[model samples]
Target chain A: MTETRLTEKTAGIRDVAARAGVSQTTVSHVLNATPHTRVSEETAARVRVAAEELGYRPNRLARGLRTQASEMIGLLTEEIATTPHAGRIILGAQEEASRHNLTLAIINSELNPDPEVPPVQVQAFLDRQVDGIIYATVYHDEIVAPENLSARPAVLIGARDSSGILPAVLPDERAGAVAVVEMLVARGHRRIAFAASAEDVPATRGRLGGYLEAMAAAGLPTEGLVAEGSSDARGGYTATNALLDAGPTALFCYNDRMAMGAYRAAGECGLSIPGDLSVVGFDDQAPIPESLFPPLTTVALPHYEMGAWAVDALYAVVSGSGERATSFAPTLLPCPLVERESVAAPRA
Target chain B: MTETRLTEKTAGIRDVAARAGVSQTTVSHVLNATPHTRVSEETAARVRVAAEELGYRPNRLARGLRTQASEMIGLLTEEIATTPHAGRIILGAQEEASRHNLTLAIINSELNPDPEVPPVQVQAFLDRQVDGIIYATVYHDEIVAPENLSARPAVLIGARDSSGILPAVLPDERAGAVAVVEMLVARGHRRIAFAASAEDVPATRGRLGGYLEAMAAAGLPTEGLVAEGSSDARGGYTATNALLDAGPTALFCYNDRMAMGAYRAAGECGLSIPGDLSVVGFDDQAPIPESLFPPLTTVALPHYEMGAWAVDALYAVVSGSGERATSFAPTLLPCPLVERESVAAPRA
Candidate 1:
């Protein structure tokens, strides 16, 4: 009620400056929260009150034209709904953009409709004159950056630009798989089995490769234990059922969906999770992990971290500040393992 | 690449007009793809080719200042990452926005911190001079519209504004529940049990209320049939276990997570789905419904529809065109049933 009454109409910067006994420049600096501006706390508070009392609403559009900064970042993400948890990436980017007082303008693209650069999508952002652009995708390991993307400072998430022009960030899928294996090995499970995905996506190779490297490092043989299946529950079920014939006491799935199948397989075989046959999965995806019977232990992709990192990197280039990473290898954010009740020492 | 060299530097609209042998207004109409323009296809093609040839990028910021249309809408969403498949909502809105040639500026807010309107967040959008604002929340049935939100055209998604001023759209939760029961009854399950969530969210009441109303209308007696548990898998498991003692032939869970638990309970009781027990769930949430061994028969909230609707509604109001719905009750989109493998007729 008070807010409705207090907020009537706009009072220009001049009104705020005159009311607060400050220059219009000071009012703009204080209201915009301009960096490197030294305004006393006492004066800033007075300016805010005066502005509020006068119903002063700063017009960023007018300011943007004068300053040549739209203060908007465009995010073009691919196949958002199908991905396990793309929302976290968006959430991370949106929040970090908010922290920097920049608005995130988002566009959803079809899942890599073709190998060609999405010049039309990039052009849309350029038309709006977004200060920077962030291209996010889960399907690709390397992408051809859109030609017009170079028109502004840009960043990539979940995929690297093949040309090595834009700074990029992605989850360390190999490292996460290694961590999962090391944890299981520490629990004394030498007969660990891997349920690999049939899909040829980058994640499949990264995860399987990590498993092989980690098993080798632990001086354990994976002969006849690494089975391939579709990267979902049914695949997990079939792979686990097949691997069970080898009498492995533990199973590691390519993803949480596959782990769901492993659990079902265990149930059918009269095995209790972490008791008779311990199981673990990757992509500690929401609802899947926590909703499972014993809450399956899994590795979490650094989706949120990557999203946040992209914005920070883009902002750095936008403002021409902050330590900008050289474009070479994409920054690999850690995919940490989340422990739940699904993993335990294999039954003696 | 041809695209890089072709997109080298900017060419003013005047240059495109001169090259295309058309006026600047004709070039603008064709390039902006302004609705209802009468420019012939040949002329439109020529203008586009000229603009492409000269690399003319339209300055939306300068155009916005002159025309007072930012061509942007701000979407303020609450607890985006935690919601079940909020990305679908985003995808729907974004795709629709793209169709209208409008950019969707998004900001994710923490789950409502208080009943007090989030003036600061609203102010941020207002600062950017977004032509309209869309406030989306899953936690509330109705909310107080922020004070300055009235400064521009606004719409609500997932919740209604209490003041009955701003137009809103929400999923038909109660109707969705009714559909589930009717489907079960059609499958010959008279003794259908409901695994209700213990949480106090509006979804709980909306779903449960639909069940009770539908049951009563079907002339089915509500004996010891409804069981309550937490809104997740564990809750579904415990509730399903207890309800099984009642010898119900079918179980309808509050959501898919609970259905997961129901699946577990059926396994423990040695009951084969359809032959001994049939199960159904709401929120045909990704991976959950499809990943289940027999898959799941569930209801899908019109998340995508509502998202698209909000943008269309906002656009209608922004342009002062289209059948602008009068502010009153919230528009309810349908929740359709997605049939997988879990549901079937009970055995004789």
Candidate 2:
């Protein structure tokens, strides 16, 4: 229990300007992050340092009443308890929010609880006067957000708004799968096998579709080259066993988990990775890819990118300097290939 | 990118009380979460529903100005980017905060940078006027917190504060380790080996200490049984291989990653888990324990419990209903053993 508050006198704009040896207008632009402002990095850093030293916190509530902006952004994420990568998204959003002197407050929503009504969590953000809302959903390809979300600048991540009114961003899972196949083909592997997941999630379809399309484009026969698994390490092991029976020289797993199984399967068969058999995976899940013996070469999802993009876009809207979404198409951010020791040329 | 404000008119506490057929005092006690008050769960539920129906939100700023409480808690975490379970901590704190009608804001601190000065992130939270702060660190056995942290009701997770004034909660890694050894000994395993970590962290010491203590109690010879590894899969494999030379019938890894390597070493040596040589791990890392075949039996770090405890403790202090920490010792929370399929009776 705190006995007495030790915080010093709250500093005002004039105090910050005087401390930084800058004009009040300059302090305003730096702290408020006004658009189209030209302040050198050095001067901006000085102003921020001065503000921190003087404990000058811009009265966000009062300022919101004056400028119709709260300088607070709300991120509504779904299933953070299960999704390991959700932290990455939060980190990106929080750091980017800090860069703009905006506070990023978060609330994790239960997994797609209701389809008929908007979540009450959105109203809580509005209660706190958040300037914008970013809803990150994974259960749906298209989501209908709370009608009141439009009352403030809002963006969607991992799903498009079915109303086609809100801007959205998603990872290109299909493209990432395709890239993995292409890389394997370039590595002089003709019979590249796929360990497909049996689950019916969006990613399963996207990844399988890419694998099939890439194989067809490479003029490779799919006959006996695809095996379905349950999307875990065991599934990978079983499916890789079947695919190995087909005499494939390379394996492209549905995800890093399956690739883990593939590694086990390969070790059982006494085949060294990147030498006797090349392997690749998607969804470069943390610790998994790096913890593997030879390490795994997998495709990384654009979670951090999506989080940063939402803030930058929302900040623009709040500053009245950027366009709102008018198109229904969701922007698919690239899933970059992370090469490690997993993929290599097939032996003669 | 919002076109217009569509949020409905705000509802006050009077309106909620009228809707719920309760007095304003009841509504205040329920919504403000005032301690030392008698309110039935049914009545609280009715009040909450009425508040939600009318889209009512108490003006936190106005109320805070009068009550000297911000209704906001700041959580500053270390190495959220790498600590896989940091999200668990955030989730627990957040859910608990919501239950108390408080907003939880988070700022992730980079790992152990500039050990002398207080992290600026704390000041950012202070600037916004958080009623309390929760600092979560894993790098230290005991740390000197920012001197000003005493200005508010503060709690620490994963480490003890040097000042001994701030209440802190830590996982009982040693107990968890001791439990595993005792469990194995109960299963008639006398030659159990430990795949120890080479990392110089608090966990490494705690876990090893528990194992050595437990083995001594069990009247088992640990000579030539403990082998050091790099704290990853490769390290586990090397350590297990060396330990196996002593003909141990069971293995305990420092963490999950090392257990992964132990699995590989077992597989290569033609040993079946829980059939020939049982294995256990610590940390219960996401995806790893479950992904491993035979599923690892391991210890959980009580991350969620710590997060929830910090919030509950802080709320008590804020409400002037709980004891402030005057002890130099940290509270050790139980690290529960999550028994999956990896452990079994050692082969006779």
Candidate 3:
């Protein structure tokens, strides 16, 4: 057994090689597990033992420079820092990247309509030689790919480009909305009010489509049930007020913020949640849903799942083996329903 | 002007050198703005123009390899991704790093009692040769420095180690609490009840200290005015119930969440916010404070500023200048008060 003293300086491969009584090439092959090396098992075992004893850490940057693969993935996001619930995407990607022994480098760009690639960020990532890139968004939207992004394997999370060139991973918003209505229907909500988001947003469109689809399937009239609003608390309040005129037993909101607004509206109308009215929300954003009077029953966007899948897809592309379909095949991960105290059957 | 057609391949430094009719060293010096390079201004301009014409992008990784400074800073955090408000730390760091032409790489570790540095993440950053590291916490707490972290320049954000060896940037919790009470006092509320947080947390201690200091300065009675809670909505509700018995006209909560609970408690007691009783909170965490009936008046954590400062401090350490004091000088950035609708003069 070799006694190693803790030192401020990190041990290098040369130290391991000298300690192991082996050549630097032998130490490299042993440490990297390089295939078809001429070194014997005994020599490899000695090298490993010496390396462990010396606490020798491999300089990955130097090795990556030679191999042109850093085992690092870049997560380039817009407004992720400011977005309420989008941080999970970075978490999901980070966890998955770690699982594959890959480091995820996150770069947040300013939220703007300009389509140009953030030159500094892209250049930094390129300089780092990140094996692949995951371009994620705070919301579901169409985007223009940064020029030369194709130089490295790339995938999109929560969004896609107009040309649909890169693969994407997104939450199944349509299915999520359908599930919300289906749950309400099961709870005996016949006259359901949909507090829809703005008409231009993709989530609003997808969720509204699902609301209409479910309404038709249940043989219920969709008219006067859908009220449009900006995806916010004030919008929910206004939409719920209008929907209340038609009298809805249940209100399905665009997102949790709007649902919070719905709660305020219900209070204004002298109604109690899950007593006089049952409410459902989407995106299940935290601190909002969980902190509500009676925690909100809402759809949890597949943020973590989408994030994990984005890395997996990017990895597949980087490895040059997996189903890296060139065409725009936006993979939709399921949005699971989080059952809280908000949902209840209609009044007797 | 020479018109260059876009090509699939990225134009290399070699291409720029050839186009500009300059040596590779001259091209490198001109592109990198390397100091002390004797290249004529005319030649530098010619090189820049040629490089721009060919869309030449310098490989930063290659340059960093020789320099041993990647201009990358690692942000190792625990639960920043899951935490509701901590993502701003990353944004602030990213923005600051960008201002210096550096890249911020984020790594989130699982929240656990064990304070071991995430080995894989540390290794990855080491491999990437990040010039420095900023170790940030989701919430303010004491932490253990990762082993041998001193090998590179590092700073702590929102936290500190037992040894206090590293430079730390933290929100001024004590001052924040003092400010909260001062705001209530300025509003002409004499009877202020403090819904305090748990006894053990550092924030609770710091904030309570501030409360006492402010109350002493105001010559207000400190006894029977402080009610301790678990720093949640339920805790706030419970504490408010006890404090209300004291017949206080205003309540100061440990956090926005507790303030929310105070609202419910106030409602149950037939009181309206700022109408019957005024309320103030700390850590103006979003959704809770803002979404309240009247937005809660609270102190905003200097998360963005702390993050930006951490990077600056780390940069100073990296640059080997600025007071990188060895002794623990925990830099407490000011927590500014954010006024909203929740505060008003106590009813006569």
Candidate 4:
């Protein structure tokens, strides 16, 4: 055996073949366990022993370069690492990728301020020749497609292009808001106050639309019931105080953080949850909803499912098996309600 | 341009060189904007125009294969994507890597159950020839080095190997705990109660040790002042109730989450914060500390800085510029206290 092959750096296939006293093809067949390779059992055993001795690992990249394929996917995320609760997208994608025997390479684009798809990371993915790419956003929004993203089959998670040309997976904010109101109304509450998220956010529009639709369906008055605030705990606090002055028996917050703020606001007003006022929240972010005094009842963002579906869609596109569209509409997944202690029947 | 070069896939450097009537090396020098390259202005302009016309991007992998270096780092994280607040590690690492023109490829090994380093991810990184690997944990703990990890320079983040062989970057939990207690003592509060974290976690031992040391230094009684909890809001709530019954004027919680619980408990007992009871917390986690009614006075985890330092250490080892030890000692960074509305002088 060559002294160089025994070094700490991984031994190559040529080294294994040399140590085993066999051709490189024979070693490859033996290591891959390729069917019908006609390699004898004794030779296979020798190859295995030689590989173990030399610490030989199959060069997956070299193999990929030869075959023009690597069972790997690239995930490009915007602000996921810096933002709260969005890392679940990466987790979901990783889980699904593993099930398909594909590894995921994640690149966070938060460091690059350029709105364009980060060229460096995209170039890296291209150099590696990933089978597909999934572009994810920290929050639901519209995105301008990067100029240099045409190399691989790509899909969007939690976002969509303005031209509607990209396949996108998103949470059904409208449905989630409808569910929250339906649950609250069923608990014998009529005077419902909506603490709306900021106007510019796409989720705010969808959630408000759902609230308006639900209120109209129930023939409940909507006048002077909507309180505007940013999508944060402080916003929820300020909005709740204003809504309380108008006398809402129940409050529906834009998100769980805002709901927590409402909890503190209720305490200051000398009101107890479920006794004098009931509360409902959206985006059942962990530790926050679960740690609340009453354990907030909220809608779960379909982040995990969206991530999984994005992978599936990207795989289909890469495999050329799914229907191809010039301009695909956004695929909306359900945001189910997580029942907890926050919501209760309105007081008599 | 050839028909293949005009396809959606990125055009190669050869295509640009052929069209620009220049050598591949010249094209590379022009595209990379290398400072010392002697390419003429006319030649550089021609290379740029050809690259733009053909949409050519240099293949980083092919270049890496030639140079035996990819200028890429692999980050193997356990549960960073699934856990809260830990993603900052990735963000910090990413920022530092970018500054050095090194891209980070992240793979979450938590999907794999084996305690050893995840073989698949390591193989992928090997295939791509990553310069180094950083194995990070979601929380501080001891880990078993994965087999076949000797090929690349590696370091641990937020964890240490049982053999003490791998260089580790960790939060100074003892120092953080000591700082918290010292700050409280300086405020003239001698009757302090500790709402401790779960006993099994490594942070718990360090924090408890620091608390005991600080109390002893202050000549205060430590017995009957430590109330154990599981490091959650509910645990804080339960432990705080027990501690308050002992007539303590202040409470130090294991974490921000637990401090929140303490707030609820104190509220239920009709005690106002700082007015009747002062509270301090560890791990100044976002939104939780900031959203609390009076805000929270807590110790910062130094997650971002630890991540940056780990990358620096790994780079040093990879470049052969720093002292390399078989069993390196743990590197502990400072955990400074963040003063906010939660801490105050004890009631007269």
Best candidate (score: TM-score)? 3
The per-prediction tally of clashing pairs is 0, 0, 0, 1
TM-score of predicted chain B versus true chain B for each candidate: 0.90, 0.87, 0.93, 0.87
- For candidate 1, what is the lDDT? 0.87
Model 2, range A112-219, lDDT digits (tens) per residue?
Answer: 656667677787787777889999886577777778787688999988888888999888988988998888888899999999999998888888999999999999
| Tens digits of per-residue lDDT for model 1, B1-348 | 323423655678899999999999999999878998899999999999998888788888888888878989988888888897688888888888999999999988776656566567788988888888888888788888776787777888988888888899998999999998988888788998999999998899999999999999898866889999988888999999989988898899999999988888888889987678888899988889999878899999898998899899988877767555565988999999998888878888
TM-score of each: 0.92, 0.89, 0.94, 0.88
Evaluate model 4: give its lDDT.
Answer: 0.81
- What ranking of all candidate models by DockQ puts the best one first? 1, 3, 2, 4
| lDDT of candidate model 2 versus the reference | 0.87
Name the runs in model 2 displaced over 4 angstroms. Answer: A1-3, A6-58, B1-3, B6-56
**What digit string (tens of lDDT, one per residue) describes model 3 on residues A176-220?**
889988989998999998998875878888888998899889988
Question: Chain A alone, model 3, TM-score?
Answer: 0.93
lDDT of 4 by residue, A60-82 (tens): 55676676666678888878665
Worst 10 residues of 2 chain B by lDDT: B1-10
Docking class of 1: medium
Span of ten consecutive residues with least summed lDDT in model 1 chain A: A1-10
**CAPRI classification of candidate 3:** medium
Q: What is the DockQ score of candidate 3, to 2 decimals?
A: 0.56
Interface RMSD of each candidate, angstroms, one decimal: 1.0, 1.9, 1.7, 2.2
Model 4 chain A — which ten-residue stretch has the worst lDDT? A1-10
